[model samples]
Target: MSGMQDRSWWGREARATVALAYPLVLTNLAQALIPATDVVLLGWAGPKVLAAGSLGVNLYNACMIFGVGVMIAASPMMARALGQRAHNVRDVRRTVRQSLWAAVALVIPIWLLLWHSEGILLLFRQEPELAKQASHLIRPMMFGMLPLFVYQVLKSFVSALERPGWAFAAGAFAVFSNAILNYALIFGKFGLPALGLYGAGLGSTISNSVMAVGLAIVVTRHRHFRRYYLFGNFWRPDWARFAQVWRLGLPIAVTLGMEVTIFNAAVFLMGMIGEPELAAHAVAIQIASLCFMVPLGIGQATTVRVGLAYGRHDRVGVGRAGWAAFGVTMVFMVCSASLMLLAPRFLVGLFLDVHTPANAHVIDLAVAFLTVAALFQLVDGAQAVGAGMLRGIHDTAVPMLFAALGYWVIGFGTAILFAFHLGWGGIGVWVGLAAGLAAAAVLMMTRWMRREKLGLI
Candidate 1:
């Protein structure tokens, strides 16, 4: 292809990816707001409540991220099925059906484990009271798991269909509903009892159920989705597809879990260092996560776009989809990194009262963390989009190995060395994080570049 034609083709794919990604990005932001609200409400309840709530929320999210990974398998599968033929309704519906089945299968054992979350926390030497209080949040929060997973399956369905607007609509409503319900129940406002952390958990539970059901209604009634008969013979089983989901999903789950748990581990490490460090780590990581939702959303879109091309055996199209996402992700990461570098204090101010004298040290540490965080933003976005690119081609096991090696072996090991032995403290942990992300980015992107040689296409 000529230079002009190549530029034009890449530009079109980039535009197409952004068009597909923005709603999903908004949806991720909406979902993020629910927890941010909880944190705010828990802060108002008390320091102890906030501590317990954070612990509980972290535990809940670790499990939820894993299950969502499993549910996400349906996205690429459906995309590929549809790309192979525009109306592979049977395969699409079957994929969704078994994804729901997989959700159920995964959630049961998880629920049993979570029911004993207090015991688990206790085993880790957490304070007994904190563990007990966290359980109050965990038990109620666990009830939301299946519903949230259901919502995830539906979300993947819409994303595969490239009609993500309704899912975003439903997520926005859920965010609003969650805030109101948590406010009422937590403070005993509007005739609700002051149940504190439990109220927060219960509020989220109800909101998730509503979101799932609302999307289900859309799937059934909307002319665009109705032809699939997604719920017809809901009891029938498809073991083959069920197995396929697990085959693809277990690795995805482990990959995501490694990524999530590494951050979670950073918190524990921060705790041992000092309250100010822990507090600062929380602030910096939250900001990074919010920024991360952008590339993460773009990555999800890349999965669909590339999966579709792969399904059609359009190798050039697959390259286009993957490279387009990579280019867009790098551009966004550059912008976000610049923001983090330019206004660390300003960003920290959003999370804490920077003017307060007592918060000075914490704010200072947070600013420092954000500086290192700024450094990692590029690699973080690259690895995320790179993983999505590989997932599009239905290659996961090796990437899972890459994630474990990069995130844990290199990342966490470096964190331990830098934070403790070398005495770099919190900054060391951030360095370790950067190292991990950098390694993962290099490995995943290299794999993507060699897709043709590796037979991934």
Candidate 2:
């Protein structure tokens, strides 16, 4: 009877988690599509454009991840509040309001940094012409950063409510709109101006604005969410709550920033190698990132579930939620890794011409990178879900240290040794990637386990 009861309980949790995760997964993939479409469209402009755009995107994302992490503090805060048996709606509303301010405030510095893309690229010793072109691409998109943060905060808000489908729908709409805009502006379709790389940036800016404003309307006007009056006096600042967000969010931001910079560092290293290697690395990483969205969505969902459980002070529930997300992520990653291993050439061909002799070198490098990417899928998913589990309980500080150690000290250091000293080239870089993600996964999962045993949640 006990065994049967256990099985039944697992089944129920599985069903609930799947229901929450699938939409969030689709939302994340749709978000990725905005950039993937840019890559596909921009590839037509030639390798220089592709490489420049890749570098610009990586730099943009490195900054964006920190903002994302800070805004994400809202979801768990709101989720935990809701999970309590008797909680103040005013407290939840205050958190939501303060988070928006924090997000917008964070966006300013990122936008300023993007505006100086050329100087930053030169500081990294990137080629002048490529740096200038990437700078052009970043300028228009700088306008979009504020709206992007707004959209992210709203998405986090809806996800905490366990109503992630609305965010998915908004993102899907944005993807379609972005594709059309890219088509029109990139090649001057339908009497549009020929902007080339700038078109991609403009399209992103317009798409982000649409998504932010559209989601804002939906969030404020939705029947269920209307009760909270999320928009009521939203502009008013709540300093204490803002401080609380900063206290909890800064570490989270640094944690995510550390992880993103690790890959960005790999991009920079590839740049030093050559344009072909850089372009190929871009394609391989894009594919790997697209596959990663599924696990990332599951991880986000796990944060909500576990956060709710923690708010209720249900340690067993937190463990169950975390482990459930881990299991699903592992299974999905296995399937993804198998696909990459079996069809690497086919996948790489999506972004570059694999059969052309002129592109053979890039194709070959990308294939090797994808192979290493496949090898790391298990650990990548583990670290992603583990971080989410820790975030659920508001444990960001230690995980931030763990990420710094794993990604920078171990991951980047090994990449440097293997790429330059051992002469592994691009392949060695990815090998180091696998090692770093594995270390992070072990550390984070162990932290969660220790917390569980000690009833920390």
Per-residue accuracy of model 1 over 330-433 as CA lDDT, tens digit each: 99999999999999999887767777887788789999999999999999999999999999999989999999999999999999999999999999999999
Candidate 1 residue runs with Cα over 4 Å from true position: 46-48
Residue 172 Cα positional deviation in candidate 1, in Å, after optimal superposition: 0.8
lDDT of prediction 2: 0.88
222: Cα error in model 1, Å? 0.8
Clash count (model 1, backbone only): 0
What TM-score against the true fold does each predicted structure earn?
Answer: 0.96, 0.98
Q: How accurate locally, in lDDT, is each candidate?
A: 0.89, 0.88
